[model samples]
Every structure is written in C-alpha cells, then in structure tokens.
Target: MTFEIAFVLLSLLGMVIALILDKMRPGMVLFSVVVLFLCAGILTPKEMLEGFSNKGMITVAMLFLVSEGVRQSGALGQVIKKLLPEGKTTVFKAQFRMLPSIAFISAFLNNTPVVVIFAPIIKRWAQSVHLPATKFLIPLSYVTILGGICTLIGTSTNLVVHGMILEAGYEGFTMFELGKVGIFIAIAGIIYLFLFSKKLLPDARPDTAVPDEEVEDGEKLHRVEAVLGARFPGINKTLADFNFQRHYGAEVKEIKTRNGQRFVTNLNQIVLREGDTLVVMADDTFIPTWGESSVFMMLANGKDTEPVPGKKKRWFALILLILMIVGATVGELPVTKEMFPNIKLDMFFFVCVTTIIMAWTKIFPARKYTKYISWDILITIACAFAISKAMVNSGVADGVAHYIIGLSHNYGPHVLLAILFVITNLFTELITNNAAAALAFPLALALSQQLGVDPTPFFVVICMAASASFSTPIGYQTNLIVQGIGNYKFMDFVRIGLPLNIITFLISVFLIPLIWPF
Candidate 1:
C-alpha cells in the first residue's frame, strides 16, 4: 500500500482505540487525531479546524441552548403529569399513551432532554401503578431515537451531515425531506416496541431505600463519588496527571488515600492508588461507566442524581419550550424569512432567545440549569465535521464510495439505497452519531455524482440511518440516560432494541428509494 493509505489506516486505527478506551472524551480523541494528521502533513491546519466553523456545529450548539430553555421552562413536567394515568393501569395501555407522544415531541426537539424529562416521571408513574419501570424506559429512549430522524433540527447528527453534504458541493437537505422515510421508520419502530418490548425487556428496578440524613449546610462540600474498576482506562494514573476536569464534566473534590487517609484535601500531586476513593463533582450520567473500569470506588450518596423540578418551575420551563418551537417554525417560513432577513430566524437564533428568556426568568435557577447542557456533545459534533472534511479531501470517502458502486454494478437504485443505509447505521453504532454522518455524507454525495442521479434519496437515507441507534446504549445519549434511570442491564437493550434496529433498517432501505427515487 502507498504511504498515504498506510498513514490514513493507522490514524483511523488510533481513533478506534481511543473510542474503545474512552479515557478521554470522544471530542478530545477526534481533536488529537486531527492534530496528529496535521503534524504529519496528511491534512492542512485549515482542514483540521474547519469543523468548528461549520454551520452544523453552530446549529448544534444553539439547539442545546434551546433544549435547555425548554427543560428549564417546566413544559415537559406538565406533559408527563397529564399523560401518566393515575390509579391502576396495565403496562401496555400506559406505554401506548405515553410513548407515542414522547416520540412525536422528540421528533421536533432534542431526544436527550426528552428522555431526561420523562425518566423520573415514568419511574414515579410505574411505582404508582405497581409495574416495573423496566418495561417502559428502554422503549422510551428507543422511540425518541427513532423519532429524531423525522426533522432536520431534531438531532445534531442530522444537521452535521447536512452541513457536510453542503460542503461537498451538493444541495443540503430541506427541513421536512427526511420525514418521508423518517416517519415510516418511526412508525415501524414504535410498533415493534409496543408489541414486543414488554416480553423482551428486563425487569431490573432499583429497590426503594430509606432516606439518609441531610448534610450540614456549612459542613457540606461539593463532592461526587465514582467507583473505578477493570474497564477504566485510567487504572494506574494519578490525580495530578489525569485531566478529568478538562475532558469529562468533573472536578476532583477530595481523595481518600490508599493508606486510609479519609478526605485528603491536598491530593493535587497524589497518585491514584487502586481501591482509593475519589470525591468529585460532575454530572451523574458519567459515574456508572467509571465503575466498569476499576478506576476508583463508588460515588458518595446523591453523586449521580438530579432532583426533579418543583411544580412552579416545571410549568414555566414547559411553556417557554413550546413557545420557542412555535416561534422557530413560524420564523422559518418563506414569508417570515423575507420579513426577517436581517434577524435570520434559524436554529441558532431560536435557541439563543429561548436560553436567554429561561435564564432571565430563573425558572430552574440559571446556574444549575446551565450545567445540564452537554458541552462535550457539542464539541464532538463540531470536530466530526472537520474529520468528515478531511475524509473527503483525502479522497478516502470517494474511494469507499467507488467500491460500493462497483459492488452493485448492475443493481438498481434500490440496492444502492440499501447499501448507504447499512453503511451509515453500522458507522453510527461504532462512533458518535454525528461523526458517522459526517463520514457517510461525503460518500453519499460521491455516489450520487457517479450514478448521475439525484442526491436527495442518498442524503435522506443517511440522516435516518444515522439516528436509528437501537442496538446499543453506548451509541446514543438518550439510550444511556434511560439505562441508568431504568436500572437496566446491557442485554436488556439488545433484546428489545436489536429488533427495532432491524425494523427501522428494513423500512429505510426499502422505502427511501420509493419515496425519493434517485
């Protein structure tokens, strides 16, 4: 093989290693690889940094703000309270009523916030009805993922791919174009979850426990605990060397030394001895994975948990979210576009206003709610665009596209569409959803160019397939959110999600060509 090919292959291998290890955040891993490529003269500095400026990156950042605003408004709380039937109800009926609405709402908003809003509500409702939450939570996340495919702004992954396609010199997707196939895939997914999820999903629910004594207000320190295990990448590292705060959303609060020195405050230079304790303050979603790696012991009580918003804040947050959606939809129209040319009514504008309004209102307390946004996710998506640009500029995407076209030499567009769907879906399972789309978008454009056909069908397929992350919780944020809240084992997701994944894949592969023929 040529040296360039060998270099690309090696760089890609390193990326895979970083993904599996997950010691550093995914965005940092991608950035590190990009820098390495630039130093090796494989990619230009501009190419390495281009993703930060991509429209997709900006849109994603704005969407986070918008989601935050809605979450702060308390809109979702009201929806949950109304949908969650009181008194005794069968698991099937309760799920049918709630899951579809959640899915539909997710099709318009971010799925992570949707899951966050619903997880506890579902849990409480399940308790009230005497049913295991396990029966509904996995399906809840799965449906949101499926529904995210229906609109451009629904997920950052879709917008990132859209920007990459635009950069590739093809026409980008319209707001509703993906809906043609997305709707069908969502329906198929919902049907699969409704009919089969109950039988296949596990019944792992956390046992109720007595409440612990409250910490003294003055004596309490801002702290979090994380258990480390064999799977952790930083097993032998020290606190001084480990850049936890820079990478993950954490700050080291205190450490218990191996010599049983409890609450060691001056641990900056201390080595992380095995079986040592680490007190940290960060988002709880990330704590569980630390235990899988044997990095430390477990979190202190209340380490990986967030309190549900009170009644007043919940109502305010929910109303603001609805208004933002209505405003964005109205603002995007041709009439509004013409009237508000200078105002520029796009995802960024909508999210900014919504965030500002929510923050000003103190609906969920500006300081606390600000921390809820996943900044790492935004950075990962931004870096994904740059990696995609590198892939296209390096001619790697074209080479892969050529191989695909060559394989289906005599086949029709239907076969070509199926190939694209499978490729995008498989890539998403392995990497970040946005990264997968970024990598796939260029190939989709190249294939359409080679075939002398319209690119919309190919683009549509990539968007839907990228968001159809049903096989693994690790693949999508929503999956992870529900996994912890539901107390689900890994295999439970596989049992229910594997079938939904297949159903969405089949529907996309067959229906996309028919709806938007090449």
Candidate 2:
C-alpha cells in the first residue's frame, strides 16, 4: 500500500479502537479521524466539511424533531398501551400483537425514539401480565431495527447511504425502494424472533431498589425509569461527584448499565454512561419536572404518574407524520419529478415542512428544539462522509477491494458479496453502525467497479449489513437502552441476537443480488 493508504488504514484502526474502548463519544472519535485525514493532505478543508452539509445528515436532524413532536404529543405511549392485551396472554400472543405494530411505527419515526417511548411501557405491561420483561425488551429493540430497514427515513443509516450514493453521482433511493428487500428481511427476522426469542431470552424480573412506601412527610415515593441520553450531565461521573439527588431532587435507587451489570449497592462508586437506565425514587413531580429534559432520552413512570395526552393532539401528530411520509413518497414519483423539476419534493423537503408546522402548532416545545436533536449522531454521520471520502481519496478502498477480489474471484461475485457483508457486519457489531457503513462504502464501490457491475447490489448489502447490528448491546443505541432497563447480561444478547444476525446475513447475501441485480 502507498503511504497515504497505509496512513488512512492505520488511522481507521485507531478510530475503531477508540470507539470500542469508549475513549470518547463516537462523533468525536470519527471527527478526530477526519481531522487527521485533513492534516495528512488526504482531504481539503472543503472536502472535510462536505459531510456537514450532506442531504442525508440534514434529513436525519429534521426527523429527530418530527419524532420529538410525536413523542411529546403522547400518542405513541397510549397506542402501545392499547396494543398489549389486558387479560392473560402467551409470550407468542403478546409478541405477535405488539412487535409488528411497533415495527411498522418505527419504519416512519426514528427507531430510537420508538424504543425510548415503548420500552418502559412494554416492561411495565410485561410485569402486569406476569411475564418476564427481559423476554420482550430485546425483541422490541430487534423489531425496530428490522422495521427501520424498510424505508429510506426509517433509520439514519439508510439516509446516510443514500446521501453517499448521491455524492457518488448515482440516484438516491426512493422512500420504499429499500422495502423491497427490507420487507422480506423484516418478515423472516420477525418470524425467527416469534419462534425462538422466548426460549432464548432470559427471565429476569425487575428489581426495585426502594419500596413504594410513604416517607415522613406523608408523601409517597414514586419509582421513575430514566434512560440516559447522550446529553446527560452526569455521564462519565460517579454519583458521589454528580450528586444525583441534590441536582434532580430524586434519589438514584439503582443503575442498570449496558455491560449488563446492575448496581443497587455502593452506586456512588460507579461511573455513569449514556444509555444507562436509572431507577430513581422521587416525589410526584419527578416525571413532570424532567419528562421533557434532554438529559434523559426517555422518562416513563414506574406507575401511571401522569394522565395520557388528549385525543386531538395524538390524532394531529399522527396525521402530520403520515403526511410527511406520503408527501415524500409521492413527490419522488416520475410525474411529480417532471412537474416540479426545480423543486425536489423528497424526504428533505417534506421533513422541513412538517417540522416547521409542528413547531408553529406547538406539537413539541419549539423553543427547546435543540434538545430534540441528537447533535452527536449528526456529527458522527457528517464525519462519516469525510472519512469515506478520505478512504476513496487515498486509494485505501481500491487496495482492500482488489485484495478481497483476488481471494474471491475464483468463487465469483456471490462469495465476494458474502465476504463484504461479514466484514461490514463485524464492524457494526463492534462499533457504531454509521461508522461501519462509512468504513465499508468505499470498498463496496471499488468492488463493483473492479467487477464491472452496477454498484447498487453492493450498496444494498452495506445498508443491510450495517443496520443488522445484533449479538451485542454496543452495536446499536436501542440495544443499550434495552440492556439497561431489562437488566440483562451481555450473554443474554449473544444467546438471542447471534442467530438473528446469521439470519440477516444469509438473507442479505442470498436476496440482495436478486433484488438489485449485480
């Protein structure tokens, strides 16, 4: 390899290590690598900053606001409650009723918000029906992931790939184009979960550190579940230093970490991290006080602490979401494209309109709009573009692609596709999915060019492999949220998600070529 290629490769290795070791936030780690590329003359300043103005990254930012509007309307929380049957039910029955709807909902809204809203409700419902919360939490996370693959806006990674494709002088994906393969994958994966998840998942019960008894002031202590977001002030600090009770007027009863450890004693010694679920004991005002705060991605009452939102607001928010989806889908039609040649009525356009309408209508708190957007994720995606560009600029992707082609040429493109899928999937399971896609995109592009085929199939595989993050909590943010709230061990995911990962791998390898011809 040339020195520039060697340097890019080594920098990527260090970036992945930093991400996996939790040396810093993922956005910072990725941004650092992009900066390194700029300093090494692999990228110009404009090239490095191109990602910040990417269409996909901007769409992702808007979707976060739309999701926040829906979340604040309290419609989803109510819908989840209705989805769960009240009477006695089997795990199969409960999953059948719950998982599919959630999958569909997540296809339009961001899956992170879907999980943030649904997890606590499902956990509470599971307890009510005398079922294991652990049995359902992982399934909830997995199904959302499956659903996200079905649409362009379903997951940020899809949009990220689309943005990269556009940047590469190809047509971007339509709203439902991914659904062709994504639907089958979702069906097969959901069926697998329905059949085996119950047997594979653990039966851990919820552990309440403090009882719901009355205190000296004749006030009842309420249990509140808070899933820490990237903005949590206490992240990386111990309770002794942060003083959780003094700051929030709530006592940290316990902390459930993504590593699958639950700390009920000596909690002051443990360092906090994003995606950690805190079981807190507070007064009646806790949920109302911190419900809309950005520090916690989600805050659900352990009991019914607040009244459900009005039917009107729920319907309005739902309608707005539907309009955003349909408008984007129809605008991409050839007829519409011809009608509005100068104005592309794509996801970006519709999302911008929807967010502004919601803001004016007071769907979500408009003033605190910054709280809704996860800037870290946005930064990560923007830097991902720059990183991918550096790979292409330095010829690292060509070098690696030729090496892989040499190994698999004897076996033909099928083996090559499988190998690429495996490599991308391994990176996703170890680090962030967006980073994984950025890392693999250039190689996929080079592979298609060397083989003299359309890069569409290779691109599809990257999307599938990148988003199909299973077998580890750290791979996806949703998994981390579930791991903490479900109080599961790392082995719990390995036991259950590993098979699903293989299923996704098999489906992507066998089906993508059929859908998007190589």
TM-score of each: 0.79, 0.97
Q: Worst lDDT window (10 residues) for model 1?
A: 291-300
User: How far is 340's C-alpha from truth in model 1 (Å)?
Assistant: 4.6
Clashes of 1: 22
Per-residue CA lDDT of model 1 for 53-116, tens digit only, reads: 8777777776766676665555666777788888988878988888789878887778866776
Q: Candidate 2 on 1-518: residue-level lDDT in tens?
A: 68998999899999999988887889999999999999999999999999999989999999999998998888888889889989899999999999899999989988987888788888888888899998899999999999999999989999999999999999989999999999998999999989998888887665755677688989998777788888788889999899888889988888888787888999999999888889898888888888777888777775653336788988999999999999999999999999999998999999999999999999987899998898999999999999999999999999999999998779888888999899999999999999999999999999999999999988988988999988999899899888877888899989988998899889888988898887
lDDT of each: 0.70, 0.90
How much is 337 displaced in model 1, in angstroms?
4.0
| CA error at residue 185 for candidate 2, angstroms | 0.8
Best by lDDT: 2
